[model samples]
Target: MKKFPEHFLWGAATSAPQSEGHGSLNGKSPSTWDKWYEINPEKFQKNQGPEHTSNMYENYIEDAKRMNDIHMNSFRTSIAWTRLLPDGKTINPEAVTFYRNYFHELHSNGVKPIINLFHFDMPWWLMEKGGWESRESVDAFAFYAETCFELFGDLVEYWTTFNEPMVHVECGYLYGYHYPAIHDLKKAVQVAFHTIMAHTMAVKAFKAGKYSGKIGIILNVSPCYPKSHSTEDLRAAELADLLNTKSFLDPAVLGIFPQKLIECLADNQLLPKVEVQDLHLIQMNPVDFIGMNYYQPRRVQAPATVNHPAVSPADFYEHYDWPDKKINPYRGWEIYPEALYDVAMMIKDQYNNIPWFVSENGMGVADEERFMDQTGMIQDDYRIEFMIEHLQQLHKGIEAGSNCFGYHTWTFVDCWSWLNGYNNRYGFYRLDLENDQRTLKKSGIWFKELIDRNGLL
Candidate 1:
């Protein structure tokens, strides 16, 4: 087994809304997720909402102890916007004290905290005011970012401006799977534009204030592979890449939108309205690093029949399931471990080999309790295999000069998902919702060994 770099980060990743319960406690206001669940509880699996999950809000000290028990040196999590600034304008003192204490606890346990500013839990007030689609919301987010830097910047050395901004745009605007579910291409373009602009401004603010840490954004980058060698298939794959990856990647790393994407947006009259200085801001503030969340590759082919111009992104290309490919039956996503290597190589060749890490990569299984043995532990050997294969590919990327640094799985403990609720569990520690007891899964114990050895066995 190959050893990871001595300084490679070994930890688990989680988000606030997903892990932290007590949705409306201690000066915490409702976020978009809270509002969405209230209005459409049926949309969530088992009609569960974010009101309670892992109870990290009250048990973070114990959680930090568990993280240390696993020999984790770093942990990635997000602070809820509503928790920090309930109205998106004023800072909540109670929330601030809670976060300060929580982060301090992590540091006391020798765990480095990588905090994200936004993780799709937008303040409900902001959503009512047009959210990221409005320029005003962008400015508000910049203010919120600056405040976070001033407050918790001393405790956290790694800060991410946004976690999977593209997912929010695509799921919320294009596919209508999230809150304010609107299916408008024009709105999607505008939302994406503003979201990136917000990231740009946040990065600029972080640098200008001389914050004591590095700042970056998390992108879920899935390499697109054409189904065939034909020009039509290639074009379809390129379009898919443009929409899914480059739309955010080009701006964050290259500091400019791809010319092809710009031309396409112009052709469709879907170009977002931009201020004269917005481009300058984006170009001036490229991120110091990037965080990639890779799950699967996109297999695309040219559409058999062109849809009308009014069609959504789904109409732009046809997705084909590759024959003979391994699939995660529980999540319905292809299990292509080699795609990690491809993504890393793409970054090396195109993005100047900026320092990056796998911010998220894991498999979620439904009805995970069925895998639990009589020992009262989840015998998730399948998850162990998943992690080993993915890490092996990541090791190959590192050896091939990818400049990758770390790999954090999707979650540390079982928690609430936005729409899926508790249907899919992706956790090292299994949370017993009935009793709020957390027990280490077999994969968690294996991860501890892997980290202690600094390599796979």
Candidate 2:
């Protein structure tokens, strides 16, 4: 095979809450997603809703078999904290048993399991207690991490402490894009600090437990592109890069936060309140691998002049501008596939040859029309093309000497997106919302063939 290395892993990624529907009866506590929909169902595209949707909770055996048929060497999925520890204190063995059996099913087919600890799903009980903002939530997260290692570390070889920490900080705290939408940069900084400390603690706890597995932090890394040659634009891009990527990348992998980030926080007088030895703890415990969920690159430009001055984040900095870019007609996220090459090379040159994997990468389209041929499969050509371009970039990364371990596309099956609801379809296997049934898209069938051969013919 000219594509993948002999030891390289090929997998598909999914999170528990997004795929394992049946939350209503599955003993799953209300996650942030649950509460968000409850608060503003109208915000979701087309008034589409979120509930027990995918039914993976009940149909994992079929899913596993399908993955096996597709020759998936590995599978990436998250453990919903709420699904396991609904009250944030009590452990749910039923949920534990369910996952154990699912991993057992995957292993039976020789599929490597990469389990993430959190993927934007926090128990509403914890959110009620102020979620990550409160120190108690940090302790709660540590306890959950420890419990997970004790329970399922043996079957799983990969443990990702989080899936995109910056999204939680920017969306949930500063921009109010995600759940518990608040508009305070101070709170954002505090939450970001606690999350770093929590990841550090999780790594320490994982190693202390003597689990023979690789642990890492997942980041949605977007390489910033300056709009023009203007100095202001370049500085804006730098700030965006530090805030969006390095804030988590540096501390998690390099054992220290970036100096530029430290200065930026201090300049705003919004430096987070930290415990006595938080910095020491973060600098001491480093991760084993870096998980990347790349969708699109962000282009930054100088801030537009604000007409009104108020006590708000708008007073802080500026918007991003991409002077030249390719566009993804389906979603507005720029279709700059070359950035994947740039991302991989940037990591190799900057991050000390750390082992990394593409945790998630896929295109989200508005409405993928159903395709049923004589052989019974849905056709999704765009998704396959998306994978081909990105994977070629990944292959180029490997050629450039990046220690890339795997390339897992964004998802296996179409599931509920956070705010977009069911508007965007990003899956190899198409999930029919009308019937709650699963059908292998033509891309899914084609992927099976490609993986069996290790690449497209």
Candidate 3:
């Protein structure tokens, strides 16, 4: 253990839909994600659906107490669009009260609450109105953001506009992870443009509200690594980085879309439809801080074949990789701890050292129940190792002068994943979905000690 910053926020992060059960608690509406779940239940790994367990909107006070048990200094939970603005045209005060009280409870218990505006949960009403495709939706999103800042900004000091804009593009357009799934390059370009515009708009609203708080965007920056020094490989890696990470990072923080990205879109005539004033707002309004969610480094390599079955030549894959990368056996995602170092350093150098936080990072293990064995609790040692390694890398970057201010793991409790649903557990406290019982795993106890020790090696 080591002493770091006196105000370091060591905590856990979760989203409204992922942790909040969709159907129960009088919260009803077809979110883009919910519709996706209904249409393709088989898409999930074990027939697990989003209908079951999400810790909030169901067991708020108890779960808040569970988070207290883990001894976290902070907690990050997203405000669901469909929940807050159930019909997209109006605000739901009841929903707002539920969330307001939740945060008030956390604050009362000494946990700082970082509220994020969006987490890929688009209201179905908006989706039907062409979702992020129409510029009108951008206006609607901006208004909704202002409403949130007015209502909650007084108590919650940190506001995040969107979580993982790249994943939003990939899921909604390029790949079919979530709803309004489309694979058209033209549509993808439009959607990316709108998402950035929405983030920029949110920043504007936050500043306009005159709220005394840090307003920023949460980017799931999967640091890109090339396979080799070969020119093509390096080029491929850069393209991937531009598409996945830099697409939003540059514009929202740096206040300009990556030129390479703009050129790529222009070359294919897939350039998004932009209005006269949208560019101005994006360029002038930059975030006060950045919230990053890094689960793993993205290792891409040269496309095996040209003209992907899903995307055209314009949508080709960029080759990138870290040689001899370790794999998180349980989650099946590549484990490159050093990427966190590289990402932090790059953010300092690349984004001008904006204050940042590891808003979400954790390993997703399967059948964690088996780890209990004869004991009553599950001993998730692998998750402990994964987190420690990442933290070590983070410490290295911090020592080297990166302005990373905090670390919050993916979740505080074992809860529902998107399509994977309740199957993938990523919490320090494992929740029995069947009985709604909470048990502290070894990682939970370890995190408490880490909080007390101030740091861990």
Evaluated at residue 167, the lDDT of candidate 1 is 85
TM-score of 3: 0.95
Instruction: lDDT for model 3, please.
Output: 0.81
Q: After superposition, how far is residue 139 of candidate 3 from its true place, in Å?
A: 0.9
- Poorly placed runs, candidate 3 (over 4 Å): 22-28, 45-47, 304-315, 318-323
Model 3 C-alpha lDDT per residue in residues 339-390, reported as the tens digit of each score? 8899889889988999999999999988888899476889999989988989
The residue pairs found clashing in candidate 2 are: 300-320, 300-321, 301-321, 378-442
In model 1, residue pairs whose N, Cα or C atoms come closer than 3 Å (at least 3 residues apart or on different chains), thus clashing, are none
Clashing pairs in 3: 19-54, 19-55, 300-319, 300-320, 301-319, 301-320, 302-319
Q: lDDT per model, in order?
A: 0.91, 0.83, 0.81
Local error of candidate 1 at residue 52 (angstroms): 0.8
Find the candidate with the highest TM-score and give its number.
1
